[model samples]
Target: MFQFLKRDPVKKLRKAYDAKLEEAMHAQRNGDIRGYAMLTSEAEALWQQIEQLEKK
Candidate 1:
């Protein structure tokens, strides 16, 4: 019944992953290695979650 009102977790994760990648790129370009690495790791985790959701 309320399925239409529910948001897709994968879709949300994908969006967040994209944003993280973009931020990571900016951080790298700014020479913030630590920030870049952190964001990259976060993005990778989100990718893993997205993959798990896709496998279902």
Candidate 2:
């Protein structure tokens, strides 16, 4: 009965993933290779989670 009240985890993860990618872009532009790599890895992990959730 409260389904509407529940937030979708995948959506939240996707938002985080987008933010991470944006940050990664900025890092790359600023020549922060290390930060860019870390953010890209985190975004990739979030994408995996989103894919897994979508499969279900």
Candidate 3:
């Protein structure tokens, strides 16, 4: 009955994903290609996790 009190994993992952993407954008704009790529990859991994959770 307290389901509403439980935090949603997907939502948390999505928030992290968005933050990663934003950080990646800043990295790219700052001419840090390597950092941007790394951040993008991390964001992709988070996306995959979100997808898996959604599938469940």
The numbered model that scores best in TM-score is: 3
lDDT of 1 by residue, 1-56 (tens): 89999999999999999999999999999999999999999999999999999999
| Predicted structure 2: lDDT | 0.97
lDDT tens digits by residue: candidate 2, 1-56:
99999999999998999999999999999999999999999999999999999999
The per-prediction tally of clashing pairs is 0, 0, 0
Clash list (residue pairs), candidate 3 = none
Better of 1 and 2 by TM-score: 2
Model 2 worst lDDT run, 10 consecutive residues: 9-18
Model 1 local distance difference test score: 0.98
Total colliding residue pairs, candidate 1? 0
Say which candidate scores most in lDDT: 3
Per-candidate TM vs. native? 0.90, 0.92, 0.97
In the range 8-47, model 3's lDDT, one tens digit per residue, is 9999999999999999999999999999999999999999
Candidate 1: residue 33 lDDT (0-100) = 100
C-alpha lDDT of all candidate models, in order: 0.98, 0.97, 0.99
| TM-score-based ranking | 3, 2, 1
